[model samples]
Target: MKLSSGTIRLIIPAASLALLLAAVFYMQPRAMSYTGLNLLFNLAIPIALATIAQMLIMSINDLDLSMGTFVSFCACVAATVLQTSPLLGALIFIGAIAVYAGMGMLIHVRDLPSIVVTLGMSFVWGGLAVLLLPSPGGTAPTWARAIMTAKPPLVPMAIIASILIAAVTHYIVMRSSFGVLMRGTGGNDRSVERAGWSVIGIRAATYALAGLFAIFAGIALVGLTTSADANIALRYTLLSIAGVILGGGEFVGGKVSPIGAVIGALTLTLAGSFLSFMRISPDWQIGAQGAILIVVLALRLALNRLEKREKHQ
Candidate 1:
């Protein structure tokens, strides 16, 4: 029996993850253990959070070109201001979230392209990050470092965190009434407005939520690394988008899967580990990852076509 396109979309990410994981195990047999798994996946926690943030923006059919830079700015704040004065840092983060919400309102009210607005914000964020930590030597907060290093029973913190994020985001994006309105705003803002809801308000709220998640991503990254750099999360912009699409999210539609995005982030982390195990040079890793991701997308798209044809038959 042929699978439906929706089923195929759900299966592709898991299958890619399994295949990549098997490849990793084959390359480094020692990585089969819990310790090994933890080592390989620890970095993925932040990435998964970032992907969720991106998915939130995509839910409204908007792209955030500022994601990476904003995350870097937050990491800088976490390492310096947060570590030194918790209250100050908390206020700053709140302000940042408000700024993000304002950006959404600006985009909606002015009929501006989200890309352009976020792109300008990217420069602003990057500049702020540089001002915060010019030399990349700030320390992570003691509490954050402790939490990142914690070894829980039954599984590593990375896996546990990813699973929890998946579950929470799934409920928020797929189950909640507010989530329905948020997504509907993306699918058809006119309908949402006609229904007597404020499209601007929904968009603003969604952007604020994305900012919250992005802040978490930055904090988690700084925790794992024990330090912060202005350029630390600069690559996350493209990486988060890739993870979202890998997890069956579309660019223009309100269609997205939180669980799939989490798995996709994990898969990306494993892919990086697999490459390292294969002894690929560090300089080539990014390009190599792109090639691997392309192959996975091609296969998934081919399967999706087949499934659609089957449905018509």
Candidate 2:
């Protein structure tokens, strides 16, 4: 029996992940201890969140180039507000919600291309981040830090929390009406709109979801880094996009897979870890990831063509 196109698309990345695991074990030549597991957890959590943020927007056939910059903005602002008061810090988080919501509305109303809008927003938000903290060196209040760092004594609760959140998020997206509508929008917004759904509203919701994910990502980063800095969110914009593409999500939108995005995040985190363990330089990572993504994109296109041709036959 033949597989569906979506199943075919996921195969390569799944196999690539299995191969990545093999490479790690072969290179390490050692059993993975609790410490090693913990290290992986640390790498996985933020990256997974970042990937989810990107995936949310991609699901609606929109791009959010400002995600990293927004995340940095959230972190910097949260740090500043916490210094004043926890209530203020909470307000700033809500403000991020508002900021992103407004931006989403702008995109929907202006009908500007998502990539253009988000890229410009990235610079704007990044500038705000600089203005907020200048050069970093601010501390998140101890209370905020403690809550993020707090873990169940018996287990790596941070990892557990992330997994549970990802699971529930996946379930909601897969089992809900919103999920079906969003998927329909992704596949063909025009057709979906003909069916009486508002494409703009769905798209805006996607960006809002992305913004929430960024907020959570920012908090996680604060816990991990213990300080807010400028340019913190910059790298994530590209990295998250790369992760989504690598996970078999179409760069052009109309397809979103939470599990695929998670696997993609895992692939990136493990690849970076393997490279670091081998003493490879950081500069090489971007090139390596780009090459991998290009290959995946090409394979997806080739597979898509094959499916179309077979159907025609």
Candidate 3:
């Protein structure tokens, strides 16, 4: 039976989720009872934030390779401020994210290629993180740790928070004029500019959004770990992008479903969980994620080609 595109998309996610649950039940029934929920929340929240950050940048035909660096820097800085007061540290964390956003905006305004500029900015941010903490051994406040680790009854606060953030973002991107313009700008910056809109401004906005999302990821990491380190954001750079692409973000050059990205993030986390629970070596996970990404990317390319062929026919 032939399947509609919508049906196919639905099937992918449903199948993925079912397999994940099956693996958990098969491999770690006992441990899954106690910490399974926490582990899933832990993985989903950070990946969701990272995917959102990548999605925002992709909305304007840009990418933020500096996400990892920004996350590490922000978290490390937050740790320092938390040393004094958790409240004050949260404030500083937001401020630091704004600083990164401003830097990205300035780069866009100056007509620098987003990838190149962000790559450089990553190093600069990493250096700043190193200077601030030198390594990853700083204590987060008791309040921060509690917020990150606690699992409230009847409502997984972390999961609820993730859903809320995703919903708000989806609403803004789908229902607002800014969203329309971003989708337009992402499709073709030159055409958008010719229509009398400032591509610079739009691109700057995208970068700012990306930076804000990265800050969210940073805070989540700090909450989970109760400590800050310079290398904290490194892996997220690839993982977030992989999540975005896997979730159909590449269909329109990055204007993807925030929900889909969340689902993709969950899938990745689940995959890792399944592997680890099965006593799969850590090295295998790296290889497995890469293979999964390659398969997704190839599928995207094939779909694009088919679409193009149909248009010509």
Each prediction's number of clashing residue pairs: 0, 1, 0
Q: Is candidate 2 or candidate 3 better by TM-score?
A: 2
In model 3, which regions exceed 4 Å deviation? 1-14, 30-35, 83-95, 251-254, 295-313
> Given candidate 1, what's the lDDT at residue 91?
98
User: lDDT tens string, model 3, 1-313?
Assistant: 6555544544455456567678788776764554556666575787788888888777676777887788888778767776667677777766766766676567667877778888998899899899989866887766667777777785666667677867888886767888878888878877888999987777667666777788777777777888888998788888787777676676345356676677677777777777777687897987876775676556666766765676588
RMSD value for candidate 3 = 3.4
TM-scores, one per candidate: 0.97, 0.86, 0.84
Candidate 2 regions with alpha-carbon error over 4 angstroms: 1-8, 29-31, 141-162, 281-285, 294-313
Candidate 2 clashing pairs, residues 3+ apart or interchain? 186-254
Q: Model 1 reaches what TM-score against the true structure?
A: 0.97
Best by lDDT: 1
- lDDT for position 248 in model 1: 88
Span of 10 residues, lowest total lDDT, candidate 2: 29-38
Query: Candidate 2 lDDT, tens digit per residue, 1-313?
Result: 9897667767767777777767777777662544554565565667778888888888877888888888888778767776567788787777777777677778778877889988898888889899989987788767657766666665564557556656866775666888888778878889999999888788767677778888878777776778899787678887788778777887655677777777777777777767666676788976776666677667767877988899999
Model 1 C-alpha lDDT versus the unseen true structure:
0.92
TM-score of 2: 0.86
